[model samples]
Target: MASSMLKSAGEIQNLIFSQNQKLTHLARCGRIDEAVKLFESMPARNAVSWNCMISGLAKNGRVADARHLFDRMASKNLISWNTMIAGYSHNNRVLEASQLFDEMPKRDSYSWTLMISCYSRNGELERARWLFDSMPGVKTPVCYNAMIAGYAKNGMFQDAIVLLTEMPVSARNMVSWNSVLAGYTQNQEMVQGLKFFGEMQEKDVVSWNLMVEGFLQVGDLESAWSFFRATPCPNVASWVTMLNGFSKSGNIDEARRLFDEMPERNLVAWNAMISGYVQFLQIEEAYRLFGEMSERNSVTWTTMINGYIRIGKLEKARELLDSMPFKNVVAQTAMLTGYVQCMRMEEAVELFEKISTKDDFCWNAMISGYAHCGRMDKAVELYKRMPTKSLFSLNTIIAGHAQQGEMHKALEVFKQMRERNTVTWNSIISGLTQNGFYCDSIKHFVLLRNEGRKPDPCTYACGLAACAYLAALQVGKQLHLLLVKSGHVNDLFAGNALINMYARCGRISSAKQAFDEMASVDLISWNTLITGYALNGFGRETISLFKEMEVNGFRPDDITFVGVLSACSHAGLIDEGLKYFDSMSRDHSVERVAEHYACVVDLLGRAGRLEEAYKLVTEMPIKVNAGVWGALLGACRMHGNPDIAKFAAEKLFVIEPQKTSNYVLLSNVHADARRWEDVDRVRSLLKEIGIQKQPGCSWIDIKKKVCSFVSDDPMQPGATEVGFVLEMLCAHIRNTEIMPWSSLLDCG
Candidate 1:
């Protein structure tokens, strides 16, 4: 009976050992569900089986499941504790790993190293170093290597080198040497990297690959190729690096030559070559290579699909997507982005719904597509449905509403956001400025500073623009000082904005000063100052500046001509204005739009050549717009030409029937000519149209605050004080002496 019982026990022991081995293999292969089933059904379990399951679950991104299995282990050993710590480390749960490390009854080198590595990977290098120093016994090479890698990864080259020098001889291996070398190369310090590479007595293919990659990254292709050729035995990775370098630099022919000459090609090399072609819009070559490949992974299929999408062959892209053996979220997202680029939102939506698992990127892409197409309602609906809201998504939504002129919606979204970055603040400030809420834009800019968010160049530019519209010179100067302090005074965008602000505030000289001080100037700079001179009635200076602008080799755009012709109009230089207008098409090749034509009409009208101006209006090549007719009517009102005024008004009525100024100008023209019946008719038509005239409004900055006043509206703050000041000024002007021009000339 004893012998029979011993025989059955031996069989049972063999069965358990075989089952443990099978479970370990299955877990390592990433068949987590099958491994779980097998684990649960095991007739008897051991430590190896349990540890294998935990490791497998963690490696497959099921950390919670691994922890649950860990807590239920019947008898835990050193290896079991180490494996659980490794699981937390691998999954980036540093806090959990550290907590578990502290709870360990007995710790080993592996446990300490795992905790250190977890901190290093998550950018908590200080904690990593602390754990490394506090390790109980003599450190192993693996532990030393982990600490050195953490230093190298975070750009602490000095610390990594010092640690390498202090490492014991047994621990000072190729990995340690390579870690320091990679630090220099990855940070673009190739000179130091090359110096270090030469110092090493032993170099591997990885070391050579780092040098080649470093050169390629900095756009030094010639140097990269030189290093590549000097490599004693270049691996597939070496050849692939050269291929990618040449292809990215628009030298595809060389890449192909190198590719064909490669002794052995891996799947990575093939994918790299294919991606290079796609990047340069050489889709046909990419497709040909895709066909020639005998082996392909998911990357290969996705690359081809993206290639078709890049060339706008969406149908082909979809065909490949459907043909993919296994569709991942990345491939599907690429197709969705393609549809969004083409504004095919419906197709994008359909594919978006088909994605079985949606990531943050997938959600943002769909929301961006809807927002870009001005479908905010749909975007918001999807945003509400998003499982996790990221900062980028919130910024996208805010920017979308602001772009579509939905300020209230944008502000509502902005206020609802619990956290914001510089981009978030910039979006709202820029939106408010663009939508003509200048005061509010500046107010937000101030609030941004008070909140301790340093404004970028764009924010400063937006603030300057608001000051320009409000003619708030004091506030503009303050922003300029702040911009200079921020070290962005030489920024092209900010400099141009400063010029515009000074110009609009009737400070033409200050505008010129800002322009002259700029380190560099583009066409917009020249145009801005020229327009400033014209708007301020400095006609001679405007003409001189235009000639100087051309002499500086800056080609004049249509906007330049607007400033030039407007200068001539304001200065009553009719002939010069006509000459410039004619030269627009002949000399400059600039097509004359309605604004140009309007300038010419104003030129003639101001010079009392109404007949000539009227003829030009009838004969201009481009169709006349409201601006052109408005210019004619204003001129008629100045010269009391009722007939031309009537003609201009009739056209204005058809083009902009509800414009209050057009009606007002026509009525003024009739009244100036003592044509009461005509005036009455125009006024009657204005009343019939039921177009309430927009009240004339103006703004002035008082003690750094922008105050607005509407004509004949008395509800503004400090209205009584303002009225008192205005009455006193008018009375003083009436009581002052008036001198004749002849007397003034005698006095001069």
Candidate 2:
């Protein structure tokens, strides 16, 4: 009986060992479900079986399941604890990993190293360093490597180098040297990377590849080529890197030569070559290579499909996608994006609906498409249907609604967002500014600042624009100070906004100062400052700036000519105005628009040349608009020319019949000429049309508050005090003038 029992025990022990080995192999192969089934059905399991299952689960991104299994383990060992910590680390669950590490009954170098690497990978470098220093035993090379890599990854080159130097010679390996080199290359510090590369006594293919890639990234093609030739033994990756470099630098022929000369070609090399051709819009060459490939993967197919889509060959892209043996979300999304770009929303939606596994990028692309096409309803519908609303989608919805003039909807979305970024604030602020909600835009900007969100350049530009429109000089100045402190004052867009704000606030000198302070200038900058000077009645300065703009090689656009002509009109420089106007199309190729014509008419009218102004109005090539006729009528009233005024008034009535200003100007002109009948006729026509003259309104910014006044309104706060002060001023002026009061009247 004892011999029989011994035989059964031996068989059972062999079975358990065989089962553990099989379970480990299955887990390593990623057959997690099969491994789980096998584990459960095993007559008995040991620690190895349990640990293998847990490791496989965590590696496969089933961290929660692994943790559950771990908690239920009958007996936990050091390997079990270390595996669980590694699981949390792999999934970026740093808090859980730290907690579990603290609960460990025992720890080893592997356990400590896992925790340190976890922190390092998750950008918690300080915690990583602390853990490294606190490690109980001798630090292993792996631990030292983790810390050094962490420093280098975070762009702390000095720290990484110092740590590397402090490492014992036994611990210092090729990885330590390469980690620093990789850091320099990744950070685009190739100059330093090259110097470091020369100092290394040992170099590998990885080191060589890194140098080649670094040169390519910075567009130094010659250096990349030189490095490529010097590499003693270039691998497939090395060849592909050089090929991609040539392709990206617009040297397609060289890429082809290198591709053909490669000693061994892999699928990766072929794909790289095709991607390079596709990137440069060489679709035919990419397709030809695709045909030559004996085997192709999803990446190969997707690259070809995207190449077709990029060149607007949507049908070809669709055909390739359909022919794909297996479809992925990437190719589907690329096709959808192609449709969106072409405004073929129906097809895009058709494809979008067929995608069973939509990623965030795919969903965001669809939403952005609908939003860009002004289909907000569909965009909102799709956004609501998303399983996970990403920040990008939220920003897109807000921008779409704001662009469509649906501020109420935009605000509703904005209010619902629990988290916001700079883009979110910028969309709302700029949208409000664009739609004429200047005050509301400024309020949101202030709210953004109060929320402790750092505003970007776009935010400041929008805020400055609101200040310009409100003539809020104090607020503008405050924003200017903030910009300088933030070190974004030199940004082109912000600089232009500052110039405009100072100009509109009647600070012409300040506007000029802002203009001069700009480190670099675009055409918009020149146009802005020139228009500012013209509006401030600095006609000579405006013309001088325009001349300087041309001398600086900026061919004036239509806007530039408008400012020049307006300056001439305001300064009564008729000859210069006519000369510039003629040179517009001939010298600058700027087509004359109605605003240009209006400026010229105003120029002649202000000079008392009503006939010449009227002739220009009738003979202009383009169809005349209300502005032209209004300019003529204003000039007629000034010179008391009733006949021409009546003609201009009749045209204005036809073009802008609801405008009360035209009637008022015509009535004044008739009264000036003593044409009582005509004046009554104009007034009667205005009344018949049911048009009411809009009240003249002006506002002043006092102590950061905008105070508004309306014509003939006396109910405003401080109105009585303002009238009293004006009366006293008039009395004092009349009584105490050294010269006669008649001279004052003449001057006025």
Candidate 1, residues 585-680, lDDT tens digits: the string is 899898898999899989998998899889999998789999899899988988989999999999999998877888889998899889999999
Global lDDT of each model?
Answer: 0.87, 0.88
Return the TM-score for each candidate structure.
Answer: 0.65, 0.65
For 564-659, candidate 2 gives per-residue lDDT tens digits of 999999999999999998989998889999999999999999999999999999899999998898889989988989999999999989988988
**Minimal lDDT window, size 10, model 2:** 739-748
Q: How high is the lDDT of residue 496 in model 2?
A: 94
lDDT computed for candidate 2: 0.88
Tell me how far the alpha carbon of residue 26 in candidate 2 is from the true structure, in angstroms, after superposition.
20
Candidate 1 residue 532 C-alpha distance from true site, Å: 6.4
